[model samples]
Target: MGWRIRNGMSISIWNDCWLLGFPVRKVTSSQSTQVDLVSDLIDMDERSWNIDLINPIFNEADIESILDIHMSNSNQNDILCWKGEGSGLYTNLLTKRVSISNFCPRCNQSIEDNTHVGRDCPYARKVWRLLDIRWSDDASNLCFKEWLLRLFMTHNKGKHICIAVTIWSLWFARNRIICEHQYPLFVAIVQKCRMYLRHFSIRTHVLAWWKPPLEPTTKLNFDVCFSYAHQKSCSGFIIRDSAGFVLGSGFIHTHHITYVFMAEALVILQGVHFAKDIGITRSTLESDSKKIT
Candidate 1:
């Protein structure tokens, strides 16, 4: 279940599912004695998040998810509802109505249920195969939830993310095919899951601003900035010592370049030449651009 905070007074910060995909009591009460209600995380006057207060307690992903939640403006009471149905409404009546279909939509074989859609469905199994996730036939007897619990217990965080997201992708793909008659490729589904996990990991992962190289080695950070108005690009690089002391810095303005990749390549070549001119034999190069890197 999830929460839609309206007044934010009644909800408890440590005992509420106010954050999406997060459970109540994310952190133990013993960890923070002062924080009680969800209102403690909000700035009543500014009507915004209290980042200064939240940053220290929550990790990056939690912080990002909290900031992204759309608060209710109705000024109504807070709502707590199941979000499993994709409509923020889950009830026994709705479940009975939706469960009328017994056959699996993808393979049109066996009964359609949690286990069928998640594991037994041929389409879902194909997706798992494409993703290189191994599934043993002996585990087929287990229900989907039980299988997932086993996976979570055995796998690391990265593998856990991959399995969960892949299962979700398979369900989504099945829905698209049934509702919209749109056929999505198995590889596309795998790629979508991978991309989501990558973005999530990047959001949660923390890294230092900069790290100095080993002794006697110089670190060169290079980047290219393009000016559309001037139809030219500038390549800048900075060389620093093991202690992060600036050894040298320089930039070169290049002629009109049609492609951004070409400009990046030229900049890297120029950076190497600059390093060589400075009599630096051991140097590590870094770039922010993924293509250039």
Candidate 2:
């Protein structure tokens, strides 16, 4: 008999052995099941966090076991229509029971589905172009499944989350337009995504500040290197210990440089200031610039 996973419960299986049950003989059929389990693990590694937006495409049992979230089909097309394309997958909203196209606020146009609202909708298309993104030309023409699968495959952890968030925000904007009979603006949607991604990166520790440790006894020939770079001059410095251990390094951003001597002088000055800040009183200052020397 085929193993069954019922709704409202979670479980795992390996080689015809239930995680909570007695072990069974290693049957060849069980091999296929094991392969699926391994694939699920690999997919999970691609993401840093998991938030289910709708019923998973797979069976409820597999989703429950893998995602740790219960899965059920709730016919969420109406919600999808309200939210813009590329969005609904990151939310917990209930999908309306009615078929999405049964009623269209934009009755002048055909009922909007996933592809229509996301790719073909006139308003959404304008938004995509403004952001310099190109969706498929024909909403109904492209291979939707293939396209979505590619998104999962190509994006890195950060960009992938951005993609999901972008779609979700777009959908939310669409819903506002449909329900309030208000016009949607493209800039608003893009801005919302930018803010959200920025915040998400901060919260997830993806975007962080770099503060190097102080070095007390760095012995470098050059305390700072100042020179003109590009049209503008910049100051840079290298820190090393008395034993020649490199401590820290960086350059500062500044306006255009007037002359090379000024650049080197500025570099020395900045390096001394930094050394002072780091509690270095007597550092051996050296520079290739004879003027600074």
Candidate 3:
């Protein structure tokens, strides 16, 4: 982990990996001093690194890395982030499992990194084009995380949401092709997504955000959050009315799930049974996994 330095006040000079490197983030030389925070090493007025202070304590390589770090002119708080990738939302399927050919299963061209699967591949690009969402020309060049950040920064809420859903759908489509050995037309997928997007609306001041279902019908949104450290996962579902009122909600612990995709599928299956137990027949089941209709 590393700090995306802004004000540099909260980050430690010798502690935080604001230098944005791997293995070790702290200064290599054991020469320690009163320098606690990176704030002391910055010229606040000029919004640049304090060269004199930095040069004395750090080694030549460390000094160069520290200077290379960009300090934003704005006073935004320092943000601690994963240095490995810019975006964490796009899942690299190969990352969680065994090694294999990095080539994209759908395109058979280019290595299937997080960015390629989410945006750069011919399949993903075609999907984005059909979605009518405008992206920068350099969109294909970025890693998945950088592309997502640019989208969120440049787009309004509705457009960003559409972009996010498209990204998720792209992953789902890729998994279906690989896991189920099914090949469906991209246009059919786009049309189904459009139907959902049309009904999505953000409610004002609502902590739990979701598009309300049609009157007399409830929406069941099932999802799972995976935690490898604990070797367990939490699966959850919430039912909401047309007015976005909470009709019912359920969550349970799930373990031994090898793939998050599989866990999500199980949650949807269990969620459907959960909804039925309450005698709600007219309900719409929603989930990030496109495994089920």
Candidate 4:
């Protein structure tokens, strides 16, 4: 029914036989085959689902004919979309489930919507500005799918990927607030996008390289304590040999540093110093702060 209105297509609701076409079905009781059905449903192509729900005439057999693909398994209990996501604080932090609380997390006035976080939220807009990308308030005011398609259409491949990373970074930033009750600065969010994109490049076959880099040949192993005292933040950095023996360590103190970047950069600078201090030329760095490195 939603699909009918979505495409401005008309369909007869009177036919019970036609209703069988809907993938929204209740599995039979005591049937182990429900797993298979679920697996089939999960494996079904996005386009096929669009067709079945849109046409409003295709039967179950027709749906099957449309799929015609092999099931990964007859036991479909493992079949899931966006697996490993569960109902928890972290899950609630990421997804917006239907509930009473719809107010914007930051503004506390506007309804929290996909577009708000992806483009319209003032925090998100600030983050975008820091990246040297201007947001068209009028264009970004559109809904999620429309905004995404527009970005994909208007920008180059690299810019599109950057857009994806930007959106993901914004969502991750929000999650930080929901999970840890810490509000990060706009610069930190942009820096996070850069770091994440760099790490992603290493993990995946995405980018060739990042600027101002020497391949991170030197490593700073830190088992340091982090603390904020007397309005100053401090951390310790330790450099270790290949055998895990401690070469040397140093203390890094920062004033008025609320976020992790200053500490991270200080640790790294101390690491390079430790490398020079210990007469070691090249090494790799490791840190317990996984998010930082």
The best candidate by TM-score is 3
Candidate 3 deviant stretches above 4 angstroms: 1-97, 202-293
Ranking under TM-score, best-scoring first? 3, 1, 4, 2
The lDDT of each candidate is 0.68, 0.46, 0.69, 0.50
Local accuracy of candidate 3 as per-residue lDDT tens digits, 88-166: 2434546767455678887797988778877778887778789887678887577666778888888887687688778
Give the range of the ten consecutive residues with the poorest summed lDDT in model 2: 75-84
Better of 2 and 3 by TM-score: 3
* Model 1: per-residue Cα lDDT over 176-238, one tens digit each: 665445689877998898899788788564322688899989898888878777778888787
- How far off is residue 274 in model 4, in Å? 41
* Collision pairs in model 3: 87-145
C-alpha lDDT of residue 177 in model 4: 61
Residue 64, model 3: Cα distance from true site in angstroms? 53
Question: Across residues 29-81, which tens digit of lDDT does each residue of candidate 4 receive?
Answer: 23232223222233244322344332343455545543443332121111111
Predicted candidate 2 versus true structure: per-residue lDDT over 82-167, tens digit per residue: 11113323222225443333333433375555555555566666665665555344433665455555655655665666667766
What's the residue-level lDDT of 27 in candidate 2?
Answer: 21
Better of 2 and 3 by lDDT: 3
Ten-residue region with minimum lDDT total, candidate 3: 79-88
Clashes of 2: 15
Residue 35 miss distance in model 1 (angstroms): 51
